[model samples]
Target: MQKPSIPKGTRDFGPAQVARRQHIFNVIRRTFESFGYAPLETPTLENLSVLTGKYGDEGDQLLFKVLNSGDFAKDVTAADLETGSKALLPKVAEKGLRYDLTVPFARYVAMNRGTLTFPFKRYQMQPVWRADRPQRGRYREFYQCDADVVGTDSLLCEAEIVLMMAQVLNGLGLDDFTIKINHRAILDDIHQAVGGVVGQEGSLYVAIDKLDKIGRDGVTQELLARGFSKSAIDRLFELLSVKGTYLEKIHALSEHIRLSIGTDYTGYTDLREVYDILQASGFKQFDRLEFDPTLARGLSYYTGCIFEVKINNVQMGSVSGGGRYDNLTGSFGLPGVSGVGFSFGVDRLYDCLEALDLFTSTAETPTRCLLTHFDAASGRAALPLLAELRAAGIPSELYPDASKLQKQFKYADAKGIPLVIIMGPEEAAAGVVKIKIMQTGVERVLPVGEVVAALTVE
Candidate 1:
């Protein structure tokens, strides 16, 4: 017999885990709605053509392609087979699991361009798959909570996204995180400062984005391995090593750009304005916000400012990340629609919260009270009371079987239910019910009519 197993990088969440994850999703959703963003949903699978080439070369390699349903191998040409999987991919597969929500969202906007309003504000919470190797805080299948605003280039859109991120993180009780902001144009300027290869600036930025993970020495070695000249490497490091307050770093970067590129750039000004806006919008009260020049978000779609969120005390990957994409939809036949958005890495954030022991009291159980009885007659008598509790907006469940008393209590305990209701002969005869608090082992006998009021109060 085969042993039961699940694929690596995937997980089966138990009751408690699901409850905590749902709490995270609910907090993010409520925050999205409060900001006037409507909900959106896209399919789990997208056309292979629609997904490829959007997430850059590295991302494209991580996509999980689906095989054609019927006799897929028969259509494979001898020449295609000789050339291997890369050449034969199109012949066998035409659809793939979505790698990220942002790309599918672009496809959705393009397909529905005629019907939707301009400057649409939307949020999506869905699972995305990647063919990535599983590790701590990383998974092959996970959820992304994304909120975006498209059809406008207003910097206020960017400001609103920053504000929304702050609200979502705060709602989740993740207060010790930092929002690191940077601009692709600023990276472009830095690239130019070192006279970087004319057409490879994006590639250079992608490498620089790994500095936080790999450290400065590692980044230097990587740039060297990527064929960066000594002068270019030196200039890039100079900009990266500049240290000061947020404003001071902005000033130093402005001076570095003027000296190295011999031209004026708006990146410094953009960073300053965003900082001021976030300050005026009350973001500072919640978490640290900084102008981090070294933050090079690896996505190829980002056209303007980018944001990466990091939990201060925990050692983990970014908990949230995204930026402005000026022409994502344009690549799919709609031209000139610009947008700004961010996505929370649901798994990583959950791990961070768990490490800090922050999920207690916030993760809500589905069934608040489990109603049990000693026998068939008592179980039948408890039905009306269970209905009353549910009608009164309490999440109450009645154990269907008149199982052994100990077995019923074990079920309630195993489910992490907070309260258990007992309707046995003694309690039924007294016109009262016994309530046990699972955590505290506290017991109380209350009149049948007052049970709902008492549970509701507690």
Candidate 2:
């Protein structure tokens, strides 16, 4: 048989890795809960129809469709198969893995519209799949920790999301990061100023969104290929390259809008108001929140304020991103509900923490102590002690088989259990337990009654 292997862009997290990942999840979950957001979950699989057009053309191509059950091709015509699979996909596939949680969440809300309360706030932590080339910091399968609020149009929801982002990062011990904020309406204003056609701003922003990924020259070349004049391209770049403080950028964009579009733009006003809310709420007390006109966020669904978070001094991509979508639920037959939220890319954030050496020793290795015995009688006698340790909330496990003492010690050392409790025949007879510190190789004998006290010390 061929050797076993996992698919590319997938990972098998070991025990230690799982513990570290749990710590990250715990941080995000606690922050979400503290903000009064309730937990939610959606299935990994959704109908192909529900996912196809939500993301743009490029995003639609990355969906991993599930084949129809047995005899999938039974209905396909000879001409359909001859033409190519793309044309025949509808007949053969009806379901696909969800590419992101936001769309699925929208679908969930729409389906339960009458049963659920208005202004629903929910947080979902789940894996999503994408059929794309995988590389460093990019995965085909990964989890997204998302918290969104629907049924409200207040900008306070947007401001609260920014503050929530700051809270979660600070809780994770990540103080060095930037939260880039922008608005789709402002992008439209820039596009209009640069002579973009009324109905084509979506495609224009999609290309302009790649400015960070591909530099100015690359974006200009793309705009040119899409039939934009060099003059328009230059003006677009000038608007994007405008620099200053958060308010200064807003002012610059406002002046450019007045000169080019000859109209007052609400997007600039909205951006300034969001920034002011953050300042007044003291979000700056913990993290850096800035207005970045170049941050387009690439998603076509975002219709209001957008967010993208990146770690400072690291080469990794944005560890978190999301924005407002005014009509996402309309496609599912629930119209007029507005929602704003953000998602934490848990895997990327994990990598950031690991690269920065921020994971604490106890967080990485969760099991604090191990209890083992030398013989069958000793093992039976040690059971009560193990029970006591567990009841005291100490993470302790007993060696299943009364194995050799050296072998047991080796297992404890390999697993990074800091303390090992040994109850041999002599110790059992004397009603005492010997404790060994794996790191220092130091040993101490304690009476049975004193074992709990020694292990319980913080």
Per-candidate RMSD vs. true structure?
1.9, 1.7
TM-score of 2: 0.96
Best by TM-score: 2
Off by over 4 Å in 1: 361-365
Best of the candidates, lDDT? 2
CA lDDT of each prediction against the hidden true structure: 0.87, 0.88
User: TM-score of every model?
Assistant: 0.95, 0.96
Clashes found in each candidate (C-alpha, N, C closer than 3 A): 0, 0
TM-score of 1: 0.95
lDDT, model 2, position 34: 89
Write candidate 1's Cα lDDT for 1-458 as tens digits. 99999999999997678889988999999988998889999999999999998888888999999999999888888899899988999989999999999999998999999999989989999999999999999999999999998998778877777788788888888888888899888888898888888887877887888988888788878888888987778888888887877888888888888886665566677777877786787666523777888998888999898999999999899999999998899889998999889999999989999999989763236898999987789988999999999999999899988789899889888777889998899899999998999899999989999999887887
lDDT of 2 at 78: 92
Model 2 weakest lDDT span, ten residues long: 278-287
Q: Candidate 2 on 1-458: residue-level lDDT in tens?
A: 99999999999998888988999999999999988899999998999989989998889999999999999999999999899978799999999999999999999999999988889999999999999899989999999999999999888888888888888888888989998999888888888889988777776887878877888888888888888899998888888888887788788878988888776567777877787787788765423877888888877899999999999967899999999999999999999999999999999999999999998874335678888887778888988988898899998889989789899988888888899988888888888888999899999999999888777885
